[model samples]
Every structure is written in structure tokens, then in C-alpha cells.
Target: YAGTGAQRVPLPTYAFQHEWFWLAPGVRPADATASGLGRVDHPVLTAVARIGDRDEWLLTGRLSIDAQPWTRDHIVFGMVLVPGAALVEMALTAGREAGCPVLDELVIESPLLLDEDATVQVQVTVGAAGEDGRREVAVFTRPERVDDDEPGEATCHGRGWLAPEGEPVTAPPGQWPPAGAEPIDVDELYRRVNKHAHLTDAGFDYGPAFRAVRSAWQVGDDVCTELELPDVAGSAQGFGVHPALLDSALHGGLGMLYRPGSEGGLPFSWSGVRLERTGSTRLRVRVGLADETALRLEISGEDGTPLARVARMDVRPVEQAQLEAARRSGRRSLHQIDWVDVPAGTPTSARVAVLGELSVPGDRYADLAGLEQAVADGAAVPEVVVTAVETAAEAGDPAERARATALSALTLVQRWLDSESLGEARLMVVTRNAVAVRDEAPELAQAPVWGLVHSAQTEHPGRFTLIDYDGGGVPDWGALLDLEEPQVAVREGRLLAPRLGRAVVGEPPTVDTGGAVLVTGGTGGLGALFARHLVERHGVKRLVLVSRRGPAAAGVGELVADLEARGAEVRVAACDVADRHRLTALFESLEGPLSGVVHAA
Candidate 1:
């Protein structure tokens, strides 16, 4: 199949041959033990032995929650997962048996998810040595079972090469901290990075576990950074290299990769990788450009010992699909807020101040103006005086403008708190649709302002009241102002107090058990719990779980299998509910009409 003039090299004979040979019947059992390393003791591995020659080895084991309790701490997108680093460790350990101490590279193809009720059998196989003295290694796993008739086939998760310890990399020259590097203000860095809500938009929303870039600096054409994993993630201790630690190491170059007011980037490929140490929580990293579009990184322990090196790393701009996937899969339950009600108190006769213009052309604006008129009429307090504060809309691009507006509102509130214009009367901060809701048009980009006000409310205690009024027709100021609830939504002229004892329970609504019930934020912890509840208690037979990752999410295969075993038809759809076009297309493609929707997202 080659071109007419193209030259081709003949293939060499296979380096290692695989032929089973049975031992003589007269051989002693003790001789078998002498031929191998015997038994291996590890939390996730067992039955280690050599095969063929010293260049080849085999390791078989099993993994379960009971055997590795710490795995539960490394959750991603609501699923307990076997960290990619764990697979690297297994490969390295197998290589060590074959006299290889360094890993060349490992490519992760699929995530290995641990099942809650089933033990998974693991196999790490290292092939015979090649000409260059490197051995090929592969890691595979399947569900453990007692029956031989239906043993589950193993799935390979990753493959790589290993070799004898390579030459030690020279440590950075001279004293620590490297001379002539200017320190970068970390606080401002995070502020600018988060300016456009980049964390959520770029799918890089990291919690304390992954926020390991402690500090950074810029040298001539090089970016230097210091990183350390959170103490709560525990010690890196026995790990060959903690995934979170390594992942954070890549983030150290974000300052160089990210362009202000542009799309963010993520690591796309790696080459010539090597790990020289194990269990390093703190590291120093130096990243330099490999060429026009790639980076060269050198990493060392905090004490200047060489640890790892990457010859080249290609970073690609993050696409919208990836951002949407991350936004849907990342933890949403952590940010859930529980609004507390304002305590009962008589209205003080101080001036009623409106922080911004409440006279726009809409039903919500009309309701706000009506409420203002009611305050002027002294509906709840005696002798009401009204004051209006003029505020400007944020200036600049969308992201910058949003931030500026938020800061302006906050500055005004701070000034009001410091002013001595009037005697102490409870200050009420009112805005329309200040609380952000999924799939809704945001109001005045005031969500960030609301966040600041909540913090101030906690510090000032009893001195300020925050109200988020849903825009609609005329508001019942008489009843709304009389209610002790501080945070509430006025919908259709009705005052609804959130998180207050104002809820009314009625008879349970009828649900079609035979019809499909759609659950948004499906594949999430809460969504999974609700799905089970629907299947067991409500007798729901068909369920649809919708999220950005859908069936590709880790642990989804086991989850679907379990649900199917229980006689429930489960369908996972990678649809963004916020995107109307995509959501409509999803509904159109469904086998049947949706009977109900649980908006748990």
C-alpha cells in the first residue's frame, strides 16, 4: 500500500513468544515458589509473580470500597472513582517487578469506577523487554464473580511503557526561589481569573482539593510556580504521584496560557513524561515554551530534589461543549443556599430609601413603583420619608461591566452603612430578581451584588434586610412589609417567604407510574437518589436522566446495569437543559411523552 518510490523497513521478529509449558509431574511445589516473587501484599494488589523471564511480570488483585476507604474522598462529578494516578501506581509497581523503576508515559482511555456492591478484579501485565529495554504495560479490570460460567470480560483502562531508572535530571541551579523572578500577586490573579465567571464558564471549577497552586512568579520567558495539595486531602504518602497534585501542577501555567477576556485552555497531550519520586505534596514547577504552541515543564520537590519532567504539553482552547459538560457535572449541591426569614419586628419610622431606579417599563417595575407609593403613604410605619439613590450601570465588556456594576453596588452599600445621615432604623435592600435561577433570564446582573449583601447581612446582623421581589403586577406592600420574613419572592401579588414556615402541604399529586419521568441534573448524587425513590416508591418503570455528560459519566454503566436489573428502564441523555434548541430536540427524540419533570438541577 505504499507509494511507488516510498521505502519500507521489514518487520523484525516478535521480541517475546507466548507458549504455555507445563512443569514435569515430578517437580516439587517448593520449586514453583523459588521461580517467582511468591506473594505480594498491598491494599489493591495481590498474587504478584514473574512470567517467562525477569523482563515480564504479572499482578492480579481486587479493589472494593472496604479495601480502599480513602477512595471515597476522591469523588468526581458525584461518583466514587479510581483515580488515574492509582492506575499509574499499579503500572509502576508491575514495572518494578521487571527491574524497571521509571514510567515513560501512560494514556488513560476510560475511567475505572468502583461499584458499591461488587468487587472489581484488576490485572497489571508487563510484557517482555524491547530493544531499548522498555517494557509495555497494560492495566485491565472487570467485576469479580464466583461463577465460572459467566465471568465478566475485563476492560483495559490504560497502557504505557516502563524502563530501568533513567539518568537523574539536574536540579535548578543556585539557591531556592531562583533569582531575578518577579512575584505575581496571587489574590489579584484569582480575582482576574474569576472576573468573567471563568471558573464556571471554562469548566475549571475546582474545590480545595484541586486548588493547589499556592503562589507563582514570572522569570525571563519562564513561569515558575509553587504548589501543595490541601491538608484535608490527607498526605500523598504512598501514592506514586497524586492525581490532584499533578493536575494542580499543570494549572501553574494558567497565567501564561490564559488571555484576559478570552477563552481558557486545558492540557491536550503530554510526551516524554517521567516520575522520579513518590508521595510529594509540595512541589516547585518551572514551565517554559517548547515551541509556538506547546510547553516544557520541569517539576521538583520543595527541597529542590528532581521529581518529574514533561518534555512537551499541548494546551488547547476549551470548547463550549466541554464547558457545558463541566458546568452540568461539577458539584452543584455545595452552593445550595438556605434563605432564613427575617424575625418579627415593628417597622421603624425612618426614611425608606430605594437603592436604585425602580421605575422601568414592565409589570415588575410597576409593582416596585406601587410598593414605593405605599411606603410614601405610611402603610406600615408612621410618617414615611422616601429617598432614591442614583446608580450607574456597569461600563465595559459584558464580563467586565458585570463586575464593575457589582462592585459599584457594594461600594454604595458600604457608604450607606458608614453614613450618619439618619438615626438607626432597619435598612432594607430591595432589588428585582437578585437571586439567580437556572434557565431564567438574569436580572440586571445583580446576582454578584446579592452575594456581597448576604455577607454584609451576616456581619451587620439586624441592621439590614435583603429582599428579592419577583417582577409582576402590583405588590401588596401592606401585607409584605407587615410579614417578618426578610427574604421573599412576590409572585402574582402573593407574598411567598422562602425558608420560612409559610409552606402549605396539600394532597399528593397523581403520577403516571407507567410513563417516563425526567430528572434534570441526572447522574448527580441527588438525581440518582431521586431516581431510586421513584423506581421503588412510586413504581416508575421508565426514567430519563439528563445531564451534559449523560452515559459517559464515570460509574454510569454500573448504575444503569443496577437499575435495569431492578426492572427499571433507564435512559441517559447528554442534553443541556439551559439550551432551548437542544432541550427541544431531546424531547422530540424521546420514545414517549414525558409524564413529569423533577427540576432537581
Candidate 2:
């Protein structure tokens, strides 16, 4: 049972983005009579379990059974978090309902991943008020700090149906109370209470910012509403407003008067908030503020139907002092952030090559540009790489096919530049293909070529022409054939056949063409060999090599310069993927319309 007059804040915002965490039978206690309500011998799987404080966010978790626990009356639990992760806190509790004692409390922290919007929820079991006289059979959510330095009350704002043990209250469509009701004139009351209320450090007020579009309220401790979302809102999903919207609803619902005299400030926190479904759809939000700070918030579909959801803090006023103290000290941020880096053994990056016919391949290029910009703006790194798929399905002569493909590739590169806000960068071409140029509208064996990368009107073949630009020069090869020096490695799943030492890089002045290849991880052994092949047999107009480490391997810079002197285009770039800030800046500095990317990085 939640204590009487426990302040509660509603959490209508958590529904759209919460992750699901169904407790396994083994994790739950079989009996409340056991010590500490059936001790959880198992350490929580931090990655799978939501962890954090109501006010702070989620950080990292380590084995620390000895860590201090947050306590209030009979309820008790510990906290876990670390730096560079998220700022969140988690808690646990035990209590009773009716005459049957029961395990009661659980809490979740907030803003777990900074700038990555989250939706969360919490659940609690309650019984009849004890001789102490609180509420009978209730659930609490959205606990807030009432005093700037004290645990605030959890408020009730949404729909509520009584537990099996208690009498249920229902409000039909139009008979419920006004939405987000304004508190009774409590300024003077707040001042009077302030004079006697003991103050403690709970945490900062999350401060509200989500804009509300529509809201409704019911008398029985719940509030429901719909809101308009913000732009550029960052979510785990590539593009959306779900997470951001829910957070705003939770924090915004905490618009309660602070009791300057009270010892406890806000009342509760949440365990998990999730967005089960999202889109340009109306959201159903429910909140039940038990008091000024303690609350139970639930969001659903447009017509009071259940949907994806989250619960909030099950906090009470009596425990505010310690929570407040933890909040004031900077140590509070330790609850939700995880610090390990993604391991590199697996392929960490991939580039997709779309090989098909299209008009204005520039449009396709633009799509890639937008994606790049999103990454630069703090989105998680993309798991898949993308590039123009080389194809031979166009309806045109040899020269026309080559021109269309290059132009399409150029369009994509330019789009990337636009997304990054780089001014008018042009495509550079390089090739060392030995085949004589074919004549389409004119004798073009030595003429410069240009056009759309994928034009619908062009006739093309339907084969994947694998080209090997081994470090050794194979002057006998032609450009029309998908030529490679027969070097082997993995390509599109299967192993590429090995054709070693096909073209030597140092003696370049050989083949000539009009395009370039951007080779990331260019300092690696395979990268060097590819560079040599491009310079020798492929007649690559340019070879740009990017690496995490500078030009330290194999005198690579000197070799590229020598190749350049022989009429090939060679450039070098140094970068690291882990350095997110630096990588963003680097992307903004790149030229556009690249023929292709060898994403070895």
C-alpha cells in the first residue's frame, strides 16, 4: 500500500518507447515470507534489465552487492550506474496488502541515454493501509522531487481500475474530471508547509518541454493525452519522435506545487518506459497522481485501448531525505551509463552497392547524403554500408552504360555532400582499364565521359563484373570486362578468388580513366594491393585511401605520390570511427560524387 498523501507525478510519455522486460518465473520470489522477499541470488543482466534512479539516468552496472541501498520504511534496494553511459537509478522494495504482506516497490531512473529518447514503465503491488493509515491496494508511478532538494510526490493522472482486493472506480466518457487539473490554491499552503517540512536532496526537476496537443482527465487518479512531437528528435530508430514525446509527457506532467516545508520532495521513479508502436498516430496516455508527487501513468491507443507502454516511479514522501542527498552529490549520475566499446572482431562496417536502372541517380545519391548527415548528428553508426550496385541492365552501348553508371554514382556522392552542408564538391574520375574505349555517338577511345549513373533508357548487361586491380599491372586486360587481378577475399558473402600481384603500384603512367575509389582501411595489406591494381591495370583516375592510423604502414604516402606522378589520382585521409566528433567533422570535409567506397573500415 502506498503511504497517504504521497506526491505522485504522471508518466503518460513513456508508452511509445519502452523496451519489454518480462520477469522469468525463476527471477520472481515464490513466497513473501522469505527473507528480503526471496533474495535474488542472480545478478541482474544490466543489458537486459532497465536500471537507474528516478531522477538521474542509466549508467553502467557492476557486481556490487555491497553497494549502499536506498531505504524507506520497510522497502529497500540498491543503485547502479557509471559515466559516459546514461543517467538513471533503480530501486526495490517490500511491503504488504490487505493483511497479506507482499513485496511492493520498484523504481527506474530517467534520460538513461543522453539525447537518445527513452520510454519507460514501473509496476508495484500494494495492500490495505496498515495501522499507519495509507491507501488500500494501490499502484504508484512517476515519483517526483517536491522540494528542489527533496523527493517530490508521485501524482495520479490517468485511468485506474482497482486491484482485485479493493473497490473499483470508473469514469465514463464525459463525466471525468478536467484534464491536468490545476492544483487548488496551494501557494500559501506550500509556504506554510515549507516552514516545517524538512528538506533533503532528491534530484533536479527534469523541467518540461514536450508540447501537448490534446489531453483528458478522469477523477480516479489518471490523466490521458495526445501530443505533437518535435523534429530532429533522436531515437534508437533511425528517424522518429516517439521517445522524445514520451519523455516530455512524463516530466511535463510533474507541474505540481512544491511544499517548501516538507522533508520528502518528489515521490517515485520508473523501472522501464517503452514505445510499443509509433508513427503519425494518436497516442493514448493515462496517469494517476496519488498525491502531489506519487503517480501511475499509462499511455494507450486513441480510444482508451491498450498499446505499447511504460510505468513510472513508485516513490513515497517518507523516503525523500536519502534520495535527495544522493541527488545533490554528483555521484547520482552513476546509475545508467554503460562504458564498453563495441568489439571489432565482427565486421563493424558494411557498404551496400545497389545495382539497378534509374533516372536521375542523383536522387538516390541524395538519400545516402541524408543518412550520412543523420549519423553526424549523433545517431548510432549504421550497421549496413550503401553504394550504387554496379549493373549491366541498361539499354545502351558500352560508352553510354559506363557514363550512366558513373553519373549515378556521382549523384549519390553529391547528395552526401549536400547533407553535410559542403559546398558544390565535384566527382573526380580515375581508371587504368586497358580496353580501348568504344564509340557510341563519336570516337571516344580517349575522350572524357560523363552522365547519369543509372539511366532508365540505357541498355545494360545483367552481370556482376568483378574487377581486380592487383598491385601488379596487367596491361592485357580491358575496361569493359569486370576485371580484377584475380586477388581473393570475401565479397558479398562468398570468398573472392585470389589473383595475387597482378599490378605493381610504383610504375604507374599506364591506364587512364575518369573516376576515383574511396578506400577506407587503406593502410591494410589488401588495401595497398587494391591501390596498386587501380594504378596499374584499372587506370583509376584517383585513389583515395582513408585509415585510422596515419601513413605509417609500408611507406604508403611515398608510394601513392609515385603512382600519382605516373598519371593516377592518389590521396590519403586519416580517421578513427570511435572518435565520433572527429568523424563528423571529417565527413563534412569530404568531396562528393565518389564512384564507389571500399568500406574496409
- TM-score of every candidate relative to the true structure: 0.43, 0.24
Give candidate 1's error at residue 137 in angstroms: 1.9
What's each prediction's clash count? Answer: 1, 179
lDDT of 2 by residue, 303-391 (tens): 54444334444444534434333333322221332222111123222322222222211223344545456556765443222232342
Model 2 lDDT-worst window of ten: 68-77
Top lDDT prediction, candidate number: 1
Best by TM-score: 1
80 Cα displacement, candidate 1 (Å): 5.8
- The global Cα lDDT (0 to 1) of model 1 is 0.64
Q: What is the C-alpha local distance difference test score of each model?
A: 0.64, 0.36
For model 1, how does the per-residue alpha-carbon lDDT over 226-339 read when each residue is reduced to its tens digit? 888765444564456666677667665655555566555545445566677777888998887786556778889998889888777665554554333433332122123334
